[model samples]
Target: MIIVGEEWEELAAALSQADAPQRVYVVGATNSGKTTLCRYLADETATHTRTAYVDCDTGQSRIGPPTTEGMVVHSRPPDPPGRAYLRFVGSTSPGGHFLQTLTGAKRLVEKAAELSAGATIIDSPGLVFGGVGVEFQFQMIDLLRPTQIVALQHGRELERLLANFARHPEVAVRRIPVSPAAVARTVTERRRYREERFTAYFADGLSQEIPLRGLGLQGRVPDLKDPHGVERRLVSFNDPENFALALGIVEEIHPRRRALTVFAPPFDPAAVASVRFGSLYLDLDADPGSMESSRP
Candidate 1:
């Protein structure tokens, strides 16, 4: 029977007594550092145990190609004490990208279970696209029941994700809030750079140049829409108002999630990357020649 509820501790105890390893699912938006964090966590757990890393970002796989031409059980090496990093890449490239990633993730999960991995960490793709993303999240939760799920969010995407995951019984969700210290550092650094650069540049006087072509010369055929002209006039970034307006456009097209949280600070890529699973270390207390390793 499957274990469930606030029995995370019980689950851990059961797994510890059991031979197989625990499994975790790492998910977040693109560029949210899900892969980097998973690598570090897996490597850390590798010592005194075997760990596997699975990449489900099939649309843009970070590790290797998707496992094809084999059943889930046959995907890993036919040997003991072996670590397999699973990934899925659609060779055909048909269907929507999110759909591909979701399907790939299901396969990865099945493979992880089959391998009886001591622990498996799965890194997933960004959740921004509409229906596909929702389907992906639900399917993953239903299949994995990950002991833990680490979600990364940047920009305005977090609210949407929070609202969706809030209803899930299996998820132990936490928000990694943007750090106050980081904000302070950003402001200070920007202020220093502003003082050093803005003074001299703005002192010399600045103005934007917009070019206009005469319709008479081009012979306006009553009414004609110029693709090149519209492309050239695409949104400008230098203006804050324009940037805000662009965000509004996105929000309109894709509604934001309804909930929010202020938990841990945003993940620090450098710190997370620095976390090594296995490295040169003398386990003087116990086993010798046992080195720990993990990804950056």
Candidate 2:
């Protein structure tokens, strides 16, 4: 889906003059072979012009670590001149669930607006459930402004996205069907592997790829003591509530006998909290001297 920004009309006029390569944005769920399709397209068109695949799937991103936390061009200089991959790693900030994740996509649009080169292929993030994921797609379209968008379908998600895309005139959305034969082969292989590798007791309610320890069941199964009830608690620790308890057990069994110098540095709690949470964003356009206090 495309949403041309301020200079889109001018850019379209410019593309009409020269041999501007068609920019394509392929969007789909995880493991839907978006990358595979991009690579195939690139290879097919490689002999004539240039091709590049911008991987924007963060968290489980496959493209070698991103150039910048936001968005940056990534391609070796000797390989091709006018072509490069625009890899965008969403946000790394803790609990950054909303617009923060679309930071990379924002940068991508800005860069795409500036380019006058060959085809720019963008592989976007999966529309994972709720509103945040759905809105992120709109943000991407606003950024990349791809002439064409290919959405791979697995369920009703693709239809929903298409309905949203129709509301905007700038984008031309299309649907392509994945081969059922290929999907059937994958399922068969997985079932075969699971039957041979794991025992019946452990394989239930789990994928064949899931490891025994990775289940978080420890050794024995958990009991449903409060199946109907619910409880909530918070601690300084991250995931898995029994982290502190496990650390206490470790200390008792094999304690490290070393004195530590823990000097608490003097810092304003309000300032520290602001910095930690990044509540105040630095204004890049502002005078450097005026913004010095906000920097490290």
**Candidate 2 Cα errors over 4 Å, as ranges:** 1-19, 66-97, 112-115, 181-296
C-alpha lDDT of residue 123 in model 2: 66
Candidate that scores best on lDDT = 2
What is candidate 1's lDDT per residue for 59-80, written digit by digit as tens?
3343432211111221222334
Q: lDDT per prediction?
A: 0.38, 0.39
In candidate 2, what are the lDDT values of residues 1-296, reduced to their tens digit?
Answer: 22223332333333334365666678776556665665545444444444445556543343322111222232333454343222222122212434534554555544544553355667676564466656667666666677777776666676655676676666667666543322322534533332332122122321111112222322111122421211110001112321111000001111133111111122222221100011112222234323212122
Query: Candidate 1 — which residues are off by over 4 angstroms?
Result: 1-21, 66-100, 129-131, 167-169, 177-296
Worst 10 residues of 1 by lDDT: 242-251
* TM-score against truth, every candidate: 0.43, 0.46
Q: What is the lDDT of candidate 2?
A: 0.39
Which candidate has the top score in TM-score?
A: 2
Clashes of 2: 1
Candidate 1 has an lDDT of 0.38
